[model samples]
Target chain A: MAEGSFQYITLAASLPHLGALFSNADLPMSRYRLEERLSMLEDEDRRRLDRIAHVTSWPGVDGCDTDAEVVARFEAASRSVQAHPDLAAVVRERLETRMLVAALRLRRDGAADPAPVAAWGRTAIARAIRTNWSEPTFGLGRARPWLRAARALCAAGDHIGLERAVLTEVYRQIDRAADDHQFDFEAVAFFVMRFQLIERWQRYDATRARGRLEALLQSTLAGAWTAGNATPTGAGMAGSLSQ
Target chain B: MTDLVLVLGWFGLFAPVALGAIGSSIGCARAGSAAIGAMLDTETGYGRFIGASLMPSSQVIYGIVIMFSLQRDPMTAEAAAGVFGVGVLAGVALLYVGIRQGEVLASAIVAAKAKPEIFGISLAPAAVLEGFAVFALVFALVLSGSIPG
Candidate 1:
């Protein structure tokens, strides 16, 4: 065969292999089933699977070649998965377990480094626990662990970790209040503002602080005006803070 | 008879001042309620805001003094009646202005609560109300002298 024709045939053959690999990797399955299937793949196919997994995993590649390049890669991977529907569960479960273990290891070793990466790990783990765990079974006694982990990361000057924890708690409180149909706008606003202020303080810069405050005021005013609520009386608890 | 006219004239001159006091009291109450509303979420530093709301009533007190001054003088029946009518008009105006001013003060308190940085801006409208009350009080003083023997 001519050199060009040989190259074409090789490429065409690889496409099917790639499709099989994508399907086997992207499919969702129980954590154990995923591990079992991954163990069964041939070495070369497993290597390809690893490359795709790393590409799609948390804190995925940044500063890509171009938007088109990124989209093409994602689309190809997705298309490959679509061609082999049976592998979906295994792919998903493997990714989830891998992420959970990586996050846990990072948390365990985070105390020594206390770097941004460690902070990210802590946050990821907290999120995983929340998503995978629920009330009465896994959630009841787990809050303290997450809080402790977050606090440790924060003490290490992990702004991202602190922010993640603060935001998560704030959202949890908001959700709870919403579910209960209790309107505590003032309390919510106050706590949220305090969290924002703390974040600003951690990332200390005078100009940025002023800008944030100005933006907060503008947003607050806009929110009130849009809601058609009573304009806040200047005499309220937040009066001093406003000043 | 002149003494009686003077006494009546004094009463007329003071009537508006009394009306103003009533108005101020109402205004103060409304302003207090608004301040309370603003302070509900954050209970600190409410005392100062409450004090500011009470500031407008000083003019009402002044109107009362003018009316008392007229009572001490002697005047004719015609002068007394004229002064009395003016006093009534001034009192009615003071009352109306006071209540409206209270509303403005309430708004100011709310503003202060929300934006302590801009609380000063809220004071302007309340000041305007105070200005009108002062104007009414001045009118009462002027009319007090017109009471008959």
Candidate 2:
């Protein structure tokens, strides 16, 4: 291990529980079960989760009937998580993505306030996103493509489709970096982001997810064929036909 | 003069084991930490994780082989210098590559835990580093033969 490198420890302490901490449970008593699991995490992680729980309580997501209140709680939780440097980067990116999606949906419906989406303007996330454009490990490359997709989706009034597109891209990023198995901060960060996306998709709209996933798969295969990289074979043809 | 020859020969005999062991120790420690973390996330793959953790230990084996090859009767100053040079340099190479391979394996283990499909592909980088260690081992063996016994 490199001197002064406690990166693996940080990752080990944090990554496994991200899905449980942020996921919206569908099962009966799952929230209580998740809370029990959260309690068992090491102190550093437990503190971060406690902060998020407090924010969630302020305008309890289920208690909030309006979309505006839900967005507010998201912002508040995102804001509070920043005090813990270890959790800040991933939390910020997650919140910004949700905010951007909410903003696009609201704007499409001619809502008066786009303020929630613009919340990132004053945050450190904006600076990080600006600085690290090509870095998939740091969650930098996601912002630009997400914004572009958000614009196109909002124009089409496909509000629910935002998550599927974002998640598809997240999965693709994970695939691209799957071979980057170095035990550094970057590798762990990528894992955390990938885990978060997997959990996010678990509760997303299934019909939209299937449609977007199929489209993504087609485009990817089409790209392979167009680039003359796809092996011309019976199996390839059959695979394409099955899809 | 005779003392100098014996001294250098002693250094040559132990250099590979010392350096190679250091490298392997660091590598195993790094990769082992990752294996423990991966185990925490998922169960029933302990065997593969343990196998991956042993990748760095190969460098030390190479070091031991080179040490045996460098052993010569009636050690002379000229032969000892050749042995010392080949042994120390090759040991250093093995050491460096082992540590690097460990880091790569650690990453591979964590990445594989998240996406098991990439497990085979993730091992490529570590295997490439191991190739470097093999190159060092082969060169040391070949150079040992050239030294006049």
Choose the strongest candidate by lDDT: 2
lDDT of 1 by residue, B30-76 (tens): 67765554554344767867886786586578667766655644456
How would you class the docking of model 1?
incorrect
What is the lDDT for A28 in model 1?
22
Residue A175 in candidate 2 has what lDDT? 43
Residue A48 lDDT (model 1): 43
Report the alpha-carbon TM-score of model 1 versus the true structure.
Answer: 0.36
Candidate 2 lDDT tens digits, A68-93: 55656667666665643433544444
lDDT of 1 by residue, A49-115 (tens): 5544544433333555543444345444434544333232223333333333333444455433323
TM-score of chain A of 2: 0.43
TM-scores, one per candidate? 0.36, 0.56
